[model samples]
Target chain A: MSVAGLYNYWIVILLMMTGFYVVISSGNLVKKIIGLNLFQASVFILYISMGKVADGGAPILREGITHYSNPLPHVLILTAIVVGVATTALGLALVVRIREAYGSVEEDDIHRQDESL
Target chain B: MIGTQLPALQVVVPLLAAPLCLALHRPFATWALTLTASALSMLVSILLLGQVLAQGVIDYAFGGWAAPFGIAYRVDLANAYVLLIVTTISTVVTIFARRSVASEVEAHNQGLFYTAWLLCLTGLLGITITGDAFNLFVFLEISSLSSYVLIAMGTERKALTAAYQYLIMGTIGATFILIGIGLLYMLTGTLNMLDMAHRLITVADSRTARTGFAFLTVGLGLKIALFPLHLWLPNAYAHAPSAVSAFLAATATKVAVYVLLRFVFSVFGVDFALGTMPLALGLAVLGTIAVLSASTVAIFQHNLKRMLAYSSVAQVGYLALGVSLATPAGLTATLLHLFNHALMKGTLFLALGCIAWRLGSVRLGDLKGLGYRMPWTMGVFVLGGLSLIGLPLTAGFISKWYLVLAALERGWWPVILVIIAGSLLAVIYIWRVIETAYLSKTNKTAGAGEAPLSMLLPAWLLAIANLYFGMHTGLSAGIATQAAAALFGIQP
Candidate 1:
């Protein structure tokens, strides 16, 4: 398999679609957060893949090497990863608060209880 | 001195205020600091707007780094207008929150509330000002995380659940947006928006660019609650505390709409977004559906806050409708409605906050006869409601007028008909509240007196401004027209 083949992007897209499916289909709120994390992780992978240079080692500035990986995409992915982590943490916190208040993590059950009220 | 630092100060003032609020710890002291910080940021935003108007555009590279290499803060006519709206709303809402927060949020949590409010303000302003695409994502998370915390601080037990729902949906939206940014960077090898715009023009017809554009549009569409993707909004708005409701209603979605505009016109260019794809027609259909369906749903909502939430969805439809027109007049209409809706809805939500403070519930049954007791508060609500319905002398009317004109300009009379029909539906929902408050003789609201002066002042100020701006459309309309024309690279 050649390194420049499109397999890496295919895997990333698969992971992203799976994560999206879980987020949309799952009834459990915690599961949805997990799915969101996976979805973001897939995006990070995509960014890292785009930054890859064929036959090039690392992105460090070397004296002899004529080509190096794109550093801009790496930096952007790092910031995006931080944002993803922040969103995950906030989502979990909200989930804990929701469980405390509603006494359930299932979306359907919470809606049922709210409707009853 | 301040003129040079205006761009940085617009964000730093609120960012620094969060820590000061935490250090103070006392509720009153935190409130005072937050208000002062918001007012200061508003002052800086005003100065920045003035500079942008006079000097064409202001670009400040962070840490003195040049553009396309380091992050830059770009202030053009479009973003300066948004900055003014965000900062001005924050200033008003912060003052209102001082009184409104005491009754809704717990005492110990008040400090944290102010901190989160400040952070949210900073994030919103930062998102509007930043020129780097990745920086926009970072600031978006700052705002989203803080907004989740603020929404959870509501007194109602359901607020936590609402916040959780918002968190999940917001995370999905953010992830989509990050992916879009990643894709764009993959193709262009840069994160700067202007640089990306320049690069995108060269490869405008590539499959990767088209896919990237689709992701960005859908992601922002979800954030701005464009029609079917707006499920998270009504619940979040309905269960959150009054102050949170007012702030988010007025600013958050407006900022998201601005982001959509930035990408559609500035980043991707109008030719690709509005011409290459059927996006304009699709958006026009969705906007019309959202207007009719959301308004119909709002008419049946028993809770005043929930009704207003659905109404907000309908108002978003109007903005989307303007964008769908894909003409300079259409963009101007969208920008105008963005400002007008912020003022009208902010006032409406603030008036509801006053009612919630006194009556402890915003359900229509509980609000019967409220007009008799809290005459001033109810008067503000009525005025806001009239504006929501697009009465001739309110801010809403001006936006609708321009939207219809844009539609008619393109010979799309069906869109004009939909606009009229949507406003009629709006009249129905607004009438529901009016009838419940005035004509009904229920005894539930017998003791509901007027709200405190602190609350009424902010609410009435926005309400009066609605009428004032509606009658005199010089400032907002002029700025919006110029901004919209600039967006299309045309002179007005």
Candidate 2:
């Protein structure tokens, strides 16, 4: 947990916060979905980083391979990736529908239209 | 044969049915399939609950793998009770959805609605049954994704926006949960909930575990619509199709509460979750704020569904308050309310759906003289409202009474006062509905009539359940106490 060794987590945290901020602050629905994706990608990285064992080989058993990195997180992350993709697709489709409904995907415009209703 | 596979079938029946529903592409057939799956799930849940009651905790490990190495379905009193509540609500709502969906969704789209319905059902039951942390996340996403679709299927355009909003929020909540699980997995090298609980004890004092716990609480707080994080709930519930609203309001947040309870008591142990982290005080304060603020907000809402949506937030506060008290009695109150609130809210929302089906809207203005036109539907609404107000001989009173008793046991007089004040606010809001429906005058009511028996029957069924459970505490309270004991890690 030295300063140099901890930099990876720091970067992951930075990316996660940035993604969260964008999702919260952005007015456009598409940008929000991208922000969500970025946030999820950072989590994937964090999980993968935790699974890494120093000098460890891939989890597959092979001749002369004594140390193996954890494989479970990778499998879990694969499932998570599928979920994230599904969410993004759903979000994008909603954005398309929102455009059809409100004639815009921007939050401000949608709000104004809703108010006038 | 079915006894052994009940845990797996509880989820698989609905999971498999979703695609079958989609493939069938016939509205009537899909509805029939959804109804059958829901009924089957409900039956299995009841059987599982009976097994748990008779034989103690039932643990079914998948594919013959044991414990931490493979996923497990662990059913004790707590989860068995949750499973029953969720499947029962689904069964009832699906029965109620026949006319609701036909009226709200286009004929071509009804199959998709049933598909999403079964997926959501599958996801909810899976979350309740699974003992693995990662498996819970998978199920959470499954339910969430399908719900977003279901919400967007509303007749109103704003349903899209509400679905989008919930998508962002739900994904954030799920991601935070994933992070927490990842950190816990890193520390313990196990994704199994029980193993993590065992391992977490040793690392309880670690900064990493503390961070993970924080992530978990906030994530689940959002999912449970706890107080300040409840922004997505009102809109999502209000704008969704009436069947979706009734189903989600009744089961979704309740399941989230179950997860929070599992994490707090069973997984983290109450000592760590409540004692160490300032979580108890935070939850209590937030719950108080929600009860007061949301109820006050509810009183002002013109839309009946929106009003009930806000009231739901307030009811969640009562559950939070019980959890914050961190006593067996307090947890019992929370569990009892979990069941009672589902009955009350399900009935209320379904009645509103019936109103909407007849009148095309549930705005307070439109509801004028509804009591005269649709006496049965309005009568159901009145019963639900009474229960919501914690009237004597209604299920709501039992939960609030238990909460008050728990507060008294702890000598928390102010909390007792807060609970009473919250109920008063509920009375005010419920009165608004009654006043608009029964007292206000309206014109052009000749075409109006009772909601079809299809809708009214299911609505009255739950309405009567509200009264039945109100008088008969043997089932709800008895199971609640046993579940609470099990949650506290006692074998009783």
Best by TM-score: 2
Candidate 2 lDDT over B1-492, as tens digits, reads 879988999999999999999999999999999999999999999999999999999899998899899999899899999999999999999999999999999999999999999999999999999999999999999999999999999999999999999999999999999999888898889988999999999998888888889999899998999989999999999999999999999999999999999989877889999999999999999999999999999999999999999999999999999998999999999999999999999999999999999989999988888889899999999999999999989999999999999999999898898899999998898888888888888776788999899999999999999999999999999999989988987765
Give the range where candidate 1 chain B is weakest over 10 consecutive residues by summed lDDT. B440-449
Once superposed on the true structure, which residue ranges of model 2 sit more than 4 Å away at CA? none
Candidate 2 predicts chain B with a TM-score of 0.99
Give interface RMSD, per candidate: 1.3, 0.4
Which residue pairs collide, candidate 2?
none
What TM value does model 2 have? Answer: 0.99
TM-score quality measure for candidate 1:
0.98
Off by over 4 Å in 1: A1-4, A62-64, B444-446
Candidate 1 CAPRI classification by DockQ: high
